[model samples]
Target: MARVLIVDDDKNIREFIRLVLEEEGYATVESTDGRDALRKIKEHPCDIAVVDVMMPYMDGISLTKEIRDIYNIPIIILTARGQIEDKELAYTAGTDDYLVKPFEAKELIFRIKALLRRYGTGEEEAPVRLGNVLLYQQNYSIKIGSKTVKLPLKEFELLYLLGKNPERVFTREQLIEDIWGLDFEGDNRTVDVHIKRLRERFRQLSVPARIHTVRGVGYSLEVDE
Candidate 1:
């Protein structure tokens, strides 16, 4: 499930949003104001933040700018005003989307899902970038600088899965189900062999990206640089 942070000073509004979001199977963290939201975001690292304007401290636009400076998570600015000026300010502050007050539950859920897909958060597939490595599905290849290599079918799919959700561990069983068919019989060794091949390929590309093993758990992709 995707995680969301809801920031609002009104207890009723916060609870309402939390209920709606939880009903849709989303994990939510609630905050009373911008400062609290910032703390929650830093500690918990949510996938998206739904912020209310005109709060006690920092305000929504300011909080958006601050979050943009640090984390790359998507932000949705919520406000009571319908003024274009407020929308422009929110967008200028780096909010990915904007929603007015009294929004319908379905609209809010739709916007959240759209933003998640656009940002490649959770399990959604999209083109991913880490340092100089670019994985694009349009061309079905990995592009490093001017050289683009179309990997073999399995290799490409495996690399794409790892790249799609960077820093998120996927156990061997999860990887097998995601990349290969669930009916395909495979052991942990299969994932190991594919990971080995990906490592060698990236080593040849000379990029900052690397796949890390989580001992007895699984594997995650990390970029150092």
Candidate 2:
């Protein structure tokens, strides 16, 4: 059973979420503010976090940013503000999803399940061998011949998605939606920047896997044998 942490200022809301999650066979933890939530997360990480944007001690956006700095745990932000700008802010702060207030419990549960399904678990058949590159998904790291290179969270995610389906092309827009959560809205150049950084790191380590640009389409990871 997955364990979920619910962070909100309202006692009623917390109890409601706790009961629902418990019914779904998930263990629940509750925090009334972001500071407490952060401490709890550091002490013991949960499978998912549902955070309210309007907390008393520390706001959800700041908390989300802090969490992103250290952990890759999935987070969903809850807010009364239904504006696109608010959603975008949540995304920029590293929320995995966003839900406006007055949402149905069923909808929240569905979103939680969907995120877990998309990111949860699967074992690789074998060590992914692409030319001189060896990607060990089990341990979440990579090697190029003799030297091992560690990837940051976002880079690893992007590379893994591309490498998993080698030949398939994905546009920047698709990537942003798929990887960075649906609410992410920044310049498309952000994708280009990350790609350039990824390519540079691989090159520095002499890795053979290449990120191919499909003009007008997007990028694909191609293993050159």
Q: In candidate 2, what are the lDDT values of residues 6-69, reduced to their tens digit?
A: 9999999999999998998788889999899988877777888899999898999998998888
lDDT per residue (tens digit) for residues 104-140 in model 1: 7766886787678668785544668878878875445
Clashes by residue pair, model 2: none
TM-scores of all candidate predictions against the true structure: 0.56, 0.54
lDDT of 1: 0.85
Best by TM-score: 1
Best by lDDT: 1
Error of 1 at 31 (Å): 0.5
In candidate 1, the residue pairs with backbone N, CA or C atoms under 3 Å apart (3 or more residues apart, or in different chains) clash, namely none
- lDDT per model, in order? 0.85, 0.82
Model 2 poorest ten-residue lDDT run: 117-126
